[model samples]
Target: MYIEQLKNKKYSLGSYIPIPLGFILLMFFNFLMSDGVDTNEVIQQTISMIGVNLTFVVLVGPLAFGLLLVLFWVKFVQGQTLRSLTTSRAKVDWKRIFFSFFLWGTITTAMILVLYYTQPENFVWNFKPEKFFIFLILAIILVPMQTSFEEYLFRAHMMQGIGLATNSRLIPLIVTSVLFGLMHIANPEVGKIGYIIMVYYIGTGFFLGIMTLMDEGLELALGFHAANNLVGALLLTADWTAFQTNSIFKDLSEPSAGFDVLTPVFVIFPILLFIFSKVYNWKNWKEKLTGKLIVTNEIDTVANDSKL
Candidate 1:
């Protein structure tokens, strides 16, 4: 139903090519340009030059603008309402969003605390009150923009577009999930921990894609993502991580592509999916996720003939 909303005269799959093509080209160029450079040193130098807060703005601001641009394209170019783009319900569900945000936010914070206590030596107090409060304000505003941009692009825009083209939920899910993972190939974590970290990134894409399809809305995915990034920004920082903010603690441990990278995808995501399925009462698993699309007219005819 959510994907079917894209079935309209104004919606041309061709018009949407430029957005993703541009994104792919950007990532490809970044990989080429940073091929031999010491990316960690580059990140550190940039942070040192501009300070952490400004560096954060420089990194996140464009994605925030990107979120706006995507919305504008959907609204003006595609002639789709923001509500239709977001969900199939009569209106956007703020409660679901808040519930998901609070749930994941709690889990993430608790996990960080457990790690901090278990391996106290690996972490150091990195909080600076003056710098932190400012960073917090900026993060609270900009982090959601960055996260929302990803969600809308992968989960909503591309997912719906691919579903419209292929007429199969499974195809869009797999395609978007893999593309979403590739989108993060240039992240510093990939360099620090090796390509194995891509399992987490791509798995995260699958997790979010499954959420969108199952829930039939982006509220949960949006909330989960925003909380994941926002809470992490406020709670932890690592030199090897993408967001090197003045958080409450800094990780000094050596980064590795180990079981930890796989645990979230293999263990935690499945558990969360179970919890969400129970909470949302999702049904029709084989149909909702893997079924072929039936357009409105066909559905009407089927119902009419069944009654006859």
Candidate 2:
């Protein structure tokens, strides 16, 4: 029914197709037009010249604006509400959003602390009081826009659009997950670690998709994503990483897609899902993940809108 709600919206595979294409075109055009910012250029000099805080905004701003454009289209053109885009519940669940945020935020931060202490030599305390404060303000405001854009595009819009088009839960789940990973193929991590790290990216997609589907909403996924990026931006900055920010510490280790990356995908994600299932009491594993998406014609008389 959550997926079926898209039927009432101005949503079709065709309609949804152009959003990402336009986003990609806009990014390319911006890249070409922006002076002295080269995607292919040396990473350190660019960061030094551009300033870490400004560079962080430049990398993330387009996706954030693109998400705004999509939200506008969803509201005006599609005649759909943000609550509908977010969840099947009566309204957006802010509790679920922050719950998932702090839950994963704790786990992620703890892991980073362990790594930091275990290999202190690999991390440089890059905290400049003034610079970090500025970076903090920008990261708090802008990082969510970046993470939310990905979640909305992949888990909210594309997941629903692809499900409606294919009329199957499994296909959309897989397609959107893989496509989400593919979207990050150009990230600096890919260049540093090679395509071998795609396993981590694609695995992350699968985790988010599973969370979105099983939770029957994007709240959990949104929180998890925001926490993941937000914590990373605040705790660590790396030359080869995407969010090259003036965070508390800078990673100087050689980047690799070894156990640190693979274990999370194969082990930690499943553990987190299991914990979520227990807490949320999620059942119907087989049906929910791979079931047919039947359109429900439930009418919400109070809101004067139809629900699926």
Candidate 3:
């Protein structure tokens, strides 16, 4: 029944036609906003970029996306249900959320510790009580917003629309994952690692997409992303990192796009993925990822034909 419902809401060819155009519009607006900002140096400019990301996060709700799909259904095709729009019918599983949160938090903490061991000098013993508390508070409020916006856009909104349109799991999974990576092209890490880092970003997208599809909801992705960002922002701050917000430990290390990007992509993420797969008992990987999307006429038929 859920699969049938998913099929009913799939988008048409014209459904995502606006996505790229929308990005272009958003970029233009961001450039205009940045024109007069007070960022003078490279570090300042990077902070300014973070500010831009924050602005986008504020504009887009934690689950703001999928509206495009709803619009497509209403304007292009007829008979989309409210459940499809609100995702109310598919219950949000909190257990998945907590599990993802714990899993990512542990993995990320381990990664940070490993990094610290390799380059202790890069970290300035910055465990000041006052600053640490401030970082904690900000994480409590803002970090989740940033992570949620990303998950909602790429993992939730875009994935749902494309899934419905293609009537298949794999196409949407691949497309949304790549787009998610592409969106990060301007990240500071990109400049450091060349395009090779994109593999990691896209890989992460694939990982989250799989979690969402198999789990039958966005709770896992949402929780994982939120926990990842929240911890990253609160636990550490580096001059070279994308988010330089007040953090507990300031990384003074010269930032290079080396093992940092690759390790997470290659080692940490895969381990986490395996852990999740085992914990959730996710099966039929090939089928769930590559399966075709099908939109049934049953729901619509029942509603309309009932009147006859």
| Top model number, TM-score | 1
RMSD for each model, in Å, please?
4.5, 4.4, 7.3
Locate the minimum summed-lDDT window of 10 residues in model 3: 299-308
1-308 per-residue lDDT for model 1 (tens digits): 67765564457788667777787788788888888776777889999899999988988899989999999988888777898788866677788788889999999999999989999999999999999999999999999999999999999988888888888999989988998898777778878888899899989999999988888889899999999999999999999988889899998999756555888999999999998888887778788789987567432211101110
Q: Highest lDDT: which candidate? A: 1
Give RMSD (Å) of candidate 1 vs. truth: 4.5
- Ranked by lDDT, the better of candidates 2 and 3 is 2
Ranking by lDDT: 1, 2, 3
Model 1 lDDT, residue 77, Cα: 81
Candidate achieving higher TM-score, 1 or 3: 1
Model 2, 1-308: lDDT tens digits are: 46766666555467667776775575566445543443435556666788777877877887787779888877776667888788876777788888899999999899889989999999999899999999888888887888898998889878887888888889989988887887776676776787788899899999999988887889889999999999988998787787887888898998757665788898999999998887777778898799987655783312211221
How accurate locally, in lDDT, is each candidate? 0.85, 0.80, 0.62
Candidate 3, residue 117: the lDDT equals 85
Writing each residue's lDDT as its tens digit, candidate 3 over 1-308 gives: 22335553444546444654576467566546544442224555544666533432443333244344434544455444433432323444566677778878887788788878897887866576775675566557666666666675566556666766666778878988887787666555555556688887898898888777765566678789888887777667765455665555678765545566676777777777787676667677777677775455554321111100
Instruction: Identify the superior model by lDDT, candidate 1 or candidate 2.
Output: 1
